[model samples]
Target: MTPAPIDIPDEIRAQVYVHALAAFPAECCGYLVGARAGVVDAVVACTNAQDQGAHPTHPERGADTGFVIAGAELLAFARAFDGDRPPRVVYHSHTNGRAYFSSVDQDLASGPAYPVQHLVVGVADGRVTEAALFAWSDNAYVEVARWQGPREGGSTA
Candidate 1:
């Protein structure tokens, strides 16, 4: 059965926006940790290892179009499932200002290397524009929630 939608608090969402903006022009990747099953309480910012030319499958692509969590961060993330506060959502940014899972994303998440949902942030012009949360359902990942970023000269409400 499909799992219930994970809950991301506003502050946590804001933190993600910040990470996305800070990595503008390049994709930022990270995960959300929760003490329980359905609600995330913290955001763990991770380095985007794509630009390091170490991405196992797509090293030719730069961070502008891809992201990979590797090395120490990856080890920690994998080990967290056995901890008290495990990650419930893995998040990444799209510098092209679109918040949909891409073909590469599908390939990486096919076997769902981890037991977590996905949050894709859309960023352009150095600011976050939109974000979408997806969860594995049936044989694919599907959108479960969405959040709109602050408009130009406006606030996030």
Candidate 2:
């Protein structure tokens, strides 16, 4: 069965958006470390590690359409976490456009690496157009929630 969707506050959403905007023209990826309780306590930016040209796996595809979280950095991040608070989400932005997960994303997320949620941000013109939460379940990636921005009545954006 699929898990319930995460309820993210507007402030946290804004932070991620800012990161994506700042990295415009280049996809930005990172890990969200926290409890399984589904609250994002921190957004740690990870190097995309995608070489601009001639990626080992798909030289033709190039780095513009891919991202790699350096294994060494990942190891150090896990070591620093103390095992109590583990990564709850893996997030990245589609710098050029489109919010949907690509086949490459599926191949990467399929590892069941951490069973954490996956968040994709849609960026265009240095602004976020759409963003959503996804999770790997059963044998595929499932959409969990779409960001609705701030709530009404001056909830803050």
Candidate 3:
């Protein structure tokens, strides 16, 4: 089966880029909104649970960054908005290189621990270079959409 498509708005893309750049040399993290055939709206700042490297040799890898969203935090965020909506997207950033879901990212993506879409941001040379979104289907990871800024093109699949 094909994975659902997602549309990331231009404004959120800019913010994701800024956040990723600010956390350069270290992994940055955040969350995404929207699911199925809906408009992707809002990008929330999230904690980088893995502040340090999982291994001694790779200290800058945010792929190993285990992300957790506290219920209280979600509840607080939920109350501010009107109507009923589920927090169905999770995001994070890579301090260096392109945006691709790492092994650790895949594991987390497919895990039942969080029922949401996964978004990854890549920061390189003091800029937000890449962005990719993914969703799990049939026990595997599938691409959703990607960010396209003035520097690079966007991907939506």
Candidate 4:
């Protein structure tokens, strides 16, 4: 059965927006850790190895349009599931001001390689404009929750 949507606290959401802004013009990738199912309490920012020519199939693409979590970070993510606080959501940012899963995202998540939801942050002009959380349902990932606004004093944007 499909699982319920994961819960990301406002402060955690703000942290994600900050990460997105910090990586502005380049997509940022990471994951959210939770003590139990359906809730996330921490955000672990990972390196976007896209520009480093680390993307398996599309190394030519820049981080501004793509992102890939590789090397040690990827290994850590893999090992997290066996820990007490596993990741519940994997998140990334889009340089364009739009928070929707792209074809590349679909391809990477086809098998869901990991048992986690996805959060996409839409950042443009060095600020977060919107964000969306997606979960696998039916035969595809669908948006389960969304937020909008700019970064200011720990808010859900």
- By summed lDDT, the worst window of 10 consecutive residues in model 1 runs over 55-64
State the TM-score for model 1. Answer: 0.87
Q: How would you encode candidate 1's per-residue C-alpha lDDT over 7-55 as one tens digit per residue?
A: 8998999999998898766678999999866679899999988755544
Query: Can you tell me which runs of candidate 3 are displaced by over 4 Å?
Result: 34-37, 52-58, 62-83, 152-157
Cα lDDT, all candidates: 0.82, 0.72, 0.66, 0.82
Candidate 4, residue 15: lDDT:
95
lDDT per residue for candidate 2 within 48-111, as digits (tens), equals 7774443455433432365777888778666745676677777888754567777888888786
Better of 3 and 4 by lDDT: 4
In order of appearance, the predictions have TM-scores of 0.87, 0.79, 0.74, 0.85
Model 3, span 1-157: residue lDDT tens: 8677556677877777777777666676766665444776777776554664344466554445654445666565455344354456677777655677777777765664556667778776677767888888778778778764346445452
Top model number, TM-score? 1
Candidate 1 residue-wise lDDT at 70: 94
Q: Pick out the ten consecutive residues of candidate 4 with the lowest summed lDDT.
A: 55-64
lDDT of 1 at 132: 93
Regions of model 2 farther than 4 Å from truth: 51-64, 80-82, 148-157
lDDT-based ranking: 1, 4, 2, 3
lDDT of 3: 0.66
